[model samples]
Target chain A: MSAAATPPASSEESTDASSPATGRIPGNRAIWVGILAELTEFTLMFLVYFFARVNHPQMFHEGPRRLSLLAGSANTLIMVSSSYLVARAVLAMRQDRPEGALRWLLAAFVVGAGYPVVKFLEVRWNLEQGLTGGGDVFQMSYYYLTFNHLVHTGWGLLGMAWVVVRTWMGAYDAKNHNGLVAFASYWHATDLVWLMIFPLFYVMP
Target chain B: MTALRKIDLAWALLVLFTLTGVFLGEFRQGGFWVVLVIALVTALKGRLVIDVFMELGEASPVLRRLVRGFGLLVPALILVTYLWGPLLARFNWLLE
Candidate 1:
């Protein structure tokens, strides 16, 4: 059924946790526990990046120049776009349009999948340019941070795949879609991490 | 505005801000002010993702604050480290 055909959501009718008007958790509490852990892990990693940069100002300044600007920019675009699509998918579900939600989710998965590919090419190019994990402190931090983020993104991509299958099977709808919402929260958190990482490594050097 | 339209707006602004950061980084020389501006931009981007994309604006106060604190704290830390990095290094040396 199209969202256009569904009646507008009434406050009296939406007493559930998923109601957009209420000050409720977007997903379940468990996923938030995981999100907090993820945030903590990244915060520690960011501290490491800052510490290394402080100690090696010259190397930090030179690092971004040696890297491929296009790769970094492309990934940033990919991440934001993918995040937007997933968000749209959730909104589509909220609108009670399962087919629309599925379409948006599949689009998000395809875009999110590009992240690993771009990262692979970027790493290969870096290796060709003599930027290895053992090269210097800057390279070490870059590899450590970005690769960690890549791993998280890999998890998020897998989650997206699972949710895609669920959506196809009519497992989610407007009222009881905690699974989808939890996955969206997770994917958004991953995207948030990437936004911070992008400037730290590529833009700010 | 419709919720979807609001998210669309947030997406547009996110892309615009990202491009702005890249432009500044590419064109401007590294300096105290440039570092400060970049840090601020990073903070703004983080807030957008939290409040808009994550849809945490109306959640529990503690949960909202915790995430928002992160969005603000990291950039503040970045700026602090940028300005006082040498001093921090010395402090570390002293501890060692």
Candidate 2:
């Protein structure tokens, strides 16, 4: 359970030495590049909305008004707590406390799952209020940004669930925990993007 | 096994409290200021999550550089669009 008892090697070496090898754990660079690409796509969509809002302010207001701040805030808290739990899980794994890490991973997974459920309800409510994506630029941007984040959140929850299972199986020690690390990074990125989107689209004018 | 460092529980609590305040304050007047403050706080929180929670501080220098580069580039691009592109549109430069 000690760091030395676990593979005392770089993440790459430990990843190679493991059973059912999936090649080297993908570097942080590759993951960041992928995330940046996705963010760029989102930014273009936001810029489109910005131009639309500038040209047609009235079209944007109705959709923005229909957004449920309460649900959005709750999801924010959930994501923040989930990120915190993932951090704690990594710390536990570093301490060679597999059971503790597994528990935290499970908790993080639960909180991550809650985000999309809240988002689904919010989207349903917006639809009921006649704010379809086709209605106007604001509705489209609202769906574009929030649903994009929700998709990321769904992937994050699946990643968390995988981390939980692997941690329970004692597959992640200090050296071989890159999967967990990558999952944590992606989850936090999702939270980071939402942190920007929530206020920009929901709280702000 | 390494001994666990004391969790930065206080800083985390501070962030949570600030976010809560921003959420509540949004319901009142001063909407623009509230949104501005919330965005700033959220950025700080994102940094905290990256540095402390994700242990970005402990990562390899190359990894840190990658993050730093992306951080700088992404915001710069956004600001450029907000400033120059909008100004060009205002001046009707694109129409010419």
Candidate 3:
């Protein structure tokens, strides 16, 4: 994202009249608006998932077994780890530990970058197993839902890259990290979506 | 005891719950209770992220409620459909 588009951490410093987080929204309000929109979109998609499952219980039952448990399991671990590391990053920055925060953020970006790589391989594996989006109702929903999530994750990775640059420039400090917090909020929301997606598509067997 | 340590603990618990969910997904005998257990775990993991990582536990009431609702919406719906497939299916005609 462009610097012009991001919420100013400077504004945060001037506006915080009480305690640090006395009347804050946690992150930028603009980002929360986006998060709300994204969550609503996913909620509707989830309803679509259940609709298909209701119409095809057998496919729903058998579909999860066909997926690579190893692949789904790998992705799950990576997503949760990435979220954890970023949460720590926020905590580190808040404690005036920029080096620690940067370290954790770098670690998070690295782990987060793994999600797409694993998904690419998982897509290949699915293809090798003769599973395509058009395979069946369950497979169709699976492909669309997960692929949409992959796109969202791509957005998150892009945002994280920007955060990396800003953090490298020493733009975020203990008292002002609104941009960093906003980026973390976005990534964590994406993580939340994947958490739900994993269970709905991969686990509820 | 510290908040940083607490975040680590939450992360550890999230990983543990995820592995448990996957284990049930892979090796379970497959029944109603199995699905319910997975759903409950999913809900717990989602709430932890919202409360701990998102810093929404002490957030304003409106923001907290929104986050909490977003976290639970999908899994709750899934459980509803899973446990009451036939009954829900009967209302499927309404959509059409």
Candidate 4:
């Protein structure tokens, strides 16, 4: 997510009285459900990762050393920065600024596109270093979890593409930008997951 | 500060925190202190993203709590696992 509403999102934007959002949850009911499911899936996988680490401490410890920390960190910065841009896009729409929102989302797409690019390089590097899923417990967990995240991020990028087109066509005004919010919600959730993943797989000491 | 400016500030802070995490990983090595610090930072960044970026800062109580709970939960779980890793590893009797 990017910025806040310079003012506040008017009440109409948050139509569902049951929604604690008041202007929260960016997207619609459906999007929140997806976000919830995604988070839960990751939570379970992270647990699996922790358990694997516990069982094979030495592997987990040495595994990351062979992986590309620079690539991981670069991706972290890319994810966070893109997430910031997405938030700004949502905020821009809420303030009746479709052009600004569109611009932000475009920037977000460009930034977000970096994730796969970096991951490609990282994977190539890992392969060269012999870090395969079949290598050991830690490497297996790392590959599975990170690859899972990459797949989800691919979905997010596709969503962003749709959002970008709609946004460009003036499909989202301040009065109705649920699409923007919904996409941002997914993007932000992905960012949150990456934040956790980064430390676990790359930066954990 | 404007919301955009605040977000920019948060972005800078997050970047700094991320770099610090990398440096800590490079210099610190595995230990309880490192685990605790990393988890704490992770929790903090999660809260910031939830509160500001996700716009739950002034949201309803339930929404606030949900996001807040998730923000705290991930790191807490990691920290707990880190603290008792060996003790828990003892249960590897079956797998071993």
Candidate 5:
């Protein structure tokens, strides 16, 4: 709920379309390397998804009806909120508000932790509904993609936990929070993946 | 606007777009246009996260474009696949 971070922007630029391109990387350049890798991994998986969907359109259409929309929606909100909180943490660091930044990161971790919990419950519910056969392309894609995402989220949570500790030690400040920024970049990238995944698996039908 | 307010607005829009996507998914069956709209919404959401939250708005043009390209390309791929999936499937042997 705290304010987020960034170099600075005008009201006009905030529209996203008109935002001035300043040629700045958020944290460190290395983070983008990781972010790009993450994107590549998902890109490959998405190709598989598109392939499966094309071959068996009916299964993809019927897949959503079988899964719980509530769970999917809940996970989407959770991922978005987590990304927002981490962004806030980065902003707090920019303002040289270490305590504030720490709080934001902590909040992010708490919220992000909900992802796996919701996922666990969702998986359990899916099993209870007898959706475990993985016989169809849709079901196979659903489990593989979501489960892969869950694994990535788990890595992100670990990173957040470490970043949270680093923030607490006053390791990052206004002029030198590249580590924090990098973490933010990775988390945002992960969040971006989930955004795409939600629609493909849950909402696209 | 303040940086905080800018991202807050972005976050708000992200949530709004997400809920709208879900609403559309819930009420309607799949179609070319519906899927296109959903893909566009998703691309927009990805752009917001990249430019705003990732603070790439003022960053290098190359980096920004690379990430933004992912945002646009994935949705475009989704659309193309949705439209020509069967034909594409015929080329599955290429993967083999």
Candidate 6:
């Protein structure tokens, strides 16, 4: 499913809404709906965190105190850079510059790869300190939220890899570049969710 | 070209500043306010990611509407649930 497999006609350049190509790609509505669904899921998780805090403030504090905000901040920067690179790739593709797009996608893939390594180290350090989620509500929430985020990050890395391979092979162009757009949206949404999660779980006191 | 480059530079600097703030604040004692500011900065960064990086600013009107609707609804839904559901649970009045 490489984007370059389908070359759009020259007439496809118009951004007019009345153009036949306007709604051809999977509508943005679906993406927004997915975002909303994930937001609802996150909200429920947050409500759980809030109720837990109300019931067990000491436990929440003890667990949160062990988190490394340094690693969290580093991961944030990495993901932000990755998003920027992906956006650049999309822009390059829109300008019909496949080589530039490929380079940017590769940059994004490299940054995406760094995230899981940092997350693995964080988890290992936490486990070394006897902070497994097997006991206590706070530990459970910690594992649940962070692990859920880790899973999404893993998927995001894989998606970026796919985009890199496709872009390298001239698989995407302006008209049929939904994969790039979709991947960027998914990756940014993951970051968006984390922007909230990091504060609520790791930073808030 | 200059305008686009400036926008990109501004976004990059904003992200760097936010990251630095978050890191410095994270290690400080009694850092709740600092973290809160970091969160606000983070949300601002998110908007940049969406508007500039994701090109939502140039998105079609229908697409924009969909994004705006979802954005507003998701937060509102959570807040309503948080506010009312807790009250109902405590009083057991809504079920009755």
Q: RMSD to the native, candidate 3? A: 5.4
lDDT of 4 at A81: 96
Better of 2 and 3 by TM-score: 3
Put down candidate 5 lDDT per residue, B69-93, tens digits, no spaces: 8788678987898888889889878
TM-score of each: 0.92, 0.75, 0.91, 0.89, 0.90, 0.75
lDDT of 1: 0.85
lDDT of 5 at B78: 79
In model 1, the number of clashes is: 0
lDDT of 4 by residue, A1-205 (tens): 3223343366553543222244344566688778888888888898788878888878877777887889989999999999999988887887788899899999999999999999999999888988887888888888899999999999999999999999999899877877787788788888888888988888875
**For candidate 3, lDDT tens digit of each residue in A115-175?**
9999999999999999998899999999999999999999999999998889889999988
DockQ-derived CAPRI band for the predicted complex in model 2:
acceptable
**Candidate 5 clash pair list:** A5-A91, A22-B58, A23-B58, A23-B59, A23-B60, A24-B58, A24-B59, A24-B60
Candidates in order have lDDT scores of 0.85, 0.62, 0.84, 0.81, 0.84, 0.64
- For candidate 1, report its TM-score: 0.92
Which residue pairs in candidate 4 collide? A1-A87, A2-A87, A2-A88, A21-A24, A205-B30
**Model 1: lDDT of residue B54:** 88
**Total backbone collisions, model 4:** 5
* DockQ of every predicted complex: 0.51, 0.27, 0.48, 0.48, 0.50, 0.27
* TM-scores (chain A) of the candidates: 0.90, 0.81, 0.89, 0.88, 0.88, 0.81
DockQ category of candidate 4? acceptable
Interface RMSD of 5: 6.5
DockQ, cand. 4: 0.48
lDDT of 4 at A68: 83
